[model samples]
Target: MFDYSEIRQVTSRDNPLVKQYIKLRDQKKYRIELGLFVLEGARLISDAISEGLRIEYAFVTEQAANKYPDTVAGLMKASIIGTYLIPSSLGDVLSATQGSQGLYCCAHTLDKISAADKMNTVGKYLVLDNLQDPGNIGTIIRAADAVGIDGIFLCGCCDIYNPKTVRSTMGSMFRVPLVDDMDYESVISLLHACGIMTFASVVDADARDIRRVHFSGGSAVVIGNEGNGLTERDASLCDQEITIKMKGNINSLNAASAASIILWEMTDEE
Candidate 1:
């Protein structure tokens, strides 16, 4: 699919491109500045490609080429600026995960939903407020996709493009529509303008029980941070406050867990 002679070899860890990849992986600021992010694993790269994200650069270890031959062949067909063949040992050193897949690549950030264009006026949506845990963020993204959420608004959350978060999504990130770095007021305003009902998922005992509430219209459930939950002002801004009715005295849940339950209830056709 591509010229074998065109593939470059990087024998030294000191190679400029190697350093650049490492920086993109390690530094969020650098990723933002370069308009690029690094990803590891063959399936993840394939997922990105399937989602129409371009591969700018790729690094493949010899072992990776041998094991994932079909993937390598497909990668050859990709419109990449540079491709490097590295040793397995170096791949191990550069790999973020304990067991390296030996295939890695860099791609520009995916385009996301923005205020410039009004989002869908119908379908379920998720709003994450100040969620700090990358794992939680990624898991929520996966859950949102699984439950068929129309879009996700990430407000004051961790960088969704963080390598760990990206890996945790298990390729779901490529499927789910996302709006990052949004604030509460903007999210509320946008949803209201679109005629979507906004429900704040909170721990308040007096809040309506989520299971009993019928979401008959285009709706959004606002999930809060891992530690503090939502501020009173944010919750009050929503049309209504809802809570999961837990057994016994359990009053709170993990951010991702809460979101999944609320999302399921919100979208439940039964």
Candidate 2:
């Protein structure tokens, strides 16, 4: 096992793993090619270990190394691990965030959901309709896991492997099977062909209150963009539109909040 604590502190800006982490953070293609995604902070690293992901590397400050010694020990066994004693200046160089938690992991990106997995969705499947915000996307993913949604379908949405999205997931990103970057038309066609009842989240007209929408076996729910809401084509594709009743002054809920509400409703709570 590599010495998690004894590894020489690296300060150079050009260290290979440091450069790779930065690239993975900034570019989409590096993440795709390496089959790796980044997870930050102590909580997410703990969660990834619990999920059995093969962590490829971890970059940590001394504080995080001490705080998560056992986790560092485990990751060191199979991974090329490095630690740095980061000053505030160096932290800014390494971290995307102002308040750096001082630790992060790179692990394999999740596998695409296969036909067998698609066929096995006997309950709720969350769908994205070109939803662009990574934070919202990540929160919805975590919510889906909490409510035991069967899988997530990312059609015409932002990349699930985006580091911001991954961080937003808070580790639930590893547990959920995510299918990404599909044609909205083909996705609708496939779901219909497979006999799944689809509910598109929309604002008005011919939509049932989410509370009243009955989700039996194998239902798919679509959540759309942060600003414009679901596209006309996406709304038209569903069997019906489902809306959360809001009596307050807010015209609409945030996409993540809306998705959580809808996923809770879709859960087979019997």
Clashing residue pairs found in predicted model 2: none
Candidate 1 per-residue lDDT, tens place, 36-104, comes to 898899888888877888788788987788788777666666747777888887887678898989998
Candidate 2, 19-115: lDDT as tens digits: 8878888888888788887777778777787788778877667666677777666656546554444444555676766687777777887666674
lDDT of each candidate versus the true structure = 0.85, 0.77
RMSD of each: 2.1, 2.6
Error of 1 at 177 (Å): 1.1
Best by TM-score: 1
TM-score of every model?
0.94, 0.90
Superposed on all Cα atoms, model 1 deviates from the true structure by an RMSD in Å of: 2.1
142: Cα error in model 2, Å: 0.8
Model 1 TM-score (2 dp): 0.94
Q: lDDT of model 1 at residue 253?
A: 95
